[model samples]
Target: MSTRGKNHSEWDSISTLYHTVVGQLTIPIAAGLVDWVHETVPLNGPGANAMDNGCGTGIVCSLLKSNYPTLPVLATDFSSAMIDEVLRNAEESGWKHFQARVLDSRNLDSVETESVTHLFTTFMICLAPDPDQIVSEMHRVLQQNGILGLAVWARPNFGFFEAAWIEACHELDPTYEAPTLMDPEWIEPENVRRGLAKAGFKSVEIKAEQQSWDWENVNAVSTYFFDGHNPGNTKWHDSWTERGQSIDKVRPLFERKLEEAYGQSDGSLKGPVPFCLAIARK
Candidate 1:
């Protein structure tokens, strides 16, 4: 698996737009994670050591702080651009407990082995080329009996922004292959559990928690696509144009599908999509 760096600058360029798209989706996901933490580990009581891997813009960091006020967190990402955004958000939000750093998961040098009390990451495992290496690094860094919490998009069931994008892709390129940005290897519960066990973790449990990208209409989803914060804009734009499809043509098709699948009486899009979240212990 390639450890090639992510294009964080493109995401940074559209940070505000990205934040808008994520703001709604994040709260439910965080709420679900909070429930999972309560079930698996104690969020309060003692001073726990926690790390939010890929702490982009510090959304999860902020959520962790709200849930575990006494927890000392080390928030890290492979991209310095992401780290900068995390720092900025932390400063602006008055989050004083987190220490932000740029560190690749394949090789974590700054943190000592077996030091972290809990490892938390959301929507990140799928981005790695070698998730096993990342799991191993987590295993090395987390204390014995420490917990690992992760959240990932489940295969789209019912309706979702991702399904709308797929519908648009089919309209543009019939044979268009979705890139493995969220690599499926990490998406599967079996694969995740196996990797965690291989990395010396035990008592892994997985669950599906439904969530969604809510928008007024499909145009909002299309706007999110072109915003360039996601790999959709950075890696997929050229392929879309090469196939002779413009955003103008594709946008309406996606909107129509979304409307057909999940339209309101007033013609807006609303509802929660499904996601799979995993919790494991070392």
Candidate 2:
């Protein structure tokens, strides 16, 4: 079971913004992981079928189709908006072998048991209402000796941004409280190993690495957190609206904290992020 709350509607609301902003921002990471999957798995053989669970913007699916044109790819997401984007992109790219579907990760009833040869999910399991059930579903869908690839945020820390935002929010409204973004247990490598093992995966290997990106200035960081189409920002704005508080009241304070913690001498922000990559065999 997941410790974090599940909100399926949130993805639908931010689908467009996520594709245009957040999904684009994570392209490098997604591409690198795809490259790793290509090298780690035998995806070039005849009749190779791959599924991208929670395939946001169809980035990974696109990469797979480009690299192995003959491979059949199934890209699924919970958001209908996201599925539309994926299908549109696939059509525009002339990817005839790719398919997109609106799917819930925890219960992939549409997929058949032992039907998939390769399964890949990037930054998705952590958001599931039941990560364990999702893993079990993954195992159920994979054929014998099939490979599973997963990438999730690991040891996620906002550095100084979180404290700054919380403080600023409190200054604006005394009763302001931060919304929980993820289940902490999901980020731990051991927990991920246990979940996969419980789901009948074998030879699981989990690796953690630090990944970072730079923001041109505090404004960019602020835009990403407050204006970006992601769960955190959406929840933050919702909380403020529920409290009858204006985000503008704390914008300055948040910017000030950004400057204090991540601002470069030239007024830019350097953020170091962490992620965990895992692979297992069914």
Candidate 3:
């Protein structure tokens, strides 16, 4: 088990703040992955359906609805709060023939074998405690020749922000130690390919590249991260608070560190975060 404890549980508390955290980066890529699925997979037809196994707040479902209004979409996430968000979206969007489930991607016991025509999981499998099992479950659920579109970070894309935050934490309390956001080997394309092959994916294609993102200014970027209740952000807050330090006191220092490294001419933050999208077939 990860020493960070159950990250999934942390995700539950930040369901509302999730969109503000990584939605800007993941949603566009999700759109692209959905479009990519459309090239081969039928969105709507008899026995034709799609599932977003690790759907966070149903970004993929919302996009799928826009593309195929009548498509049978199943949005599943480990967090009930996230499933609730999907349900809320369905209610507001008037989605038809859609379903949402609070299910872990690792063990999709509720999903049946050869059930979905396409499985799309953006920025999900990488964080899985057992990606091989997650991929195995995905393979089991997908119909013959079904495609898996998996998006993950090429590596943690925190830029200079993490180091600066750690610096501030150390200054506040010398006992501070930064956490590892991800495993190094898991991000390797070769390892991903090997894992997929083990999961019975015969044809696997992996692409690693930088995806550009924008911000009005660096403060906008900082505000989204610092001025939020995301688990990732909350940990820092908890650390700062437990150390008997006002969180506000460290903001200026962190801001200066960010501005020095990432600030643009117009005071905007940097862009073009790295990510990998693996398209595999069973």
Local distance difference test, candidate 3:
0.75
RMSD of each: 4.2, 4.7, 4.9
lDDT-best of 1 and 2 = 2
Clashing pairs in 2: none
Of the two candidates 2 and 3, the one with more favorable TM-score, higher being better, is: 2
Q: What would the per-residue lDDT of candidate 2 be over residues 1-282, giving only the tens digit for each residue?
A: 001123355677677767565564467777777766667777886667999998877778888888887788988888777787777777777886777777788888889999999899988887657888888898999999899988887743323356777777877787888776656667778988888888899998888775666778888778867776677567667877788777787888888877887778988887666777788889
Arrange candidates by lDDT, highest first: which order? 2, 3, 1
lDDT of 3 by residue, 1-282 (tens): 001112356678668877766777778888877776676565665677888888888888899988898888888888777887778878888999888877778888888999888888887776657777888899999988888888777665234357678776677677866665655545668877887888898788887766766767767767866876666567667767876888788887777776776768976777567777777888
> Each candidate's lDDT (Cα)?
0.71, 0.77, 0.75
Task: Tell me the spans in candidate 1 whose CA falls farther than 4 Å from its real position.
Answer: 1-10, 156-159, 169-173
Runs of candidate 2 with Cα error greater than 4 angstroms are 1-8, 156-161, 170-177, 240-245
**Clashes in predicted model 2:** 0
Measured with C-alpha atoms, the lDDT of residue 66 in candidate 2 is 83
How do the candidates rank by TM-score, highest first?
2, 1, 3
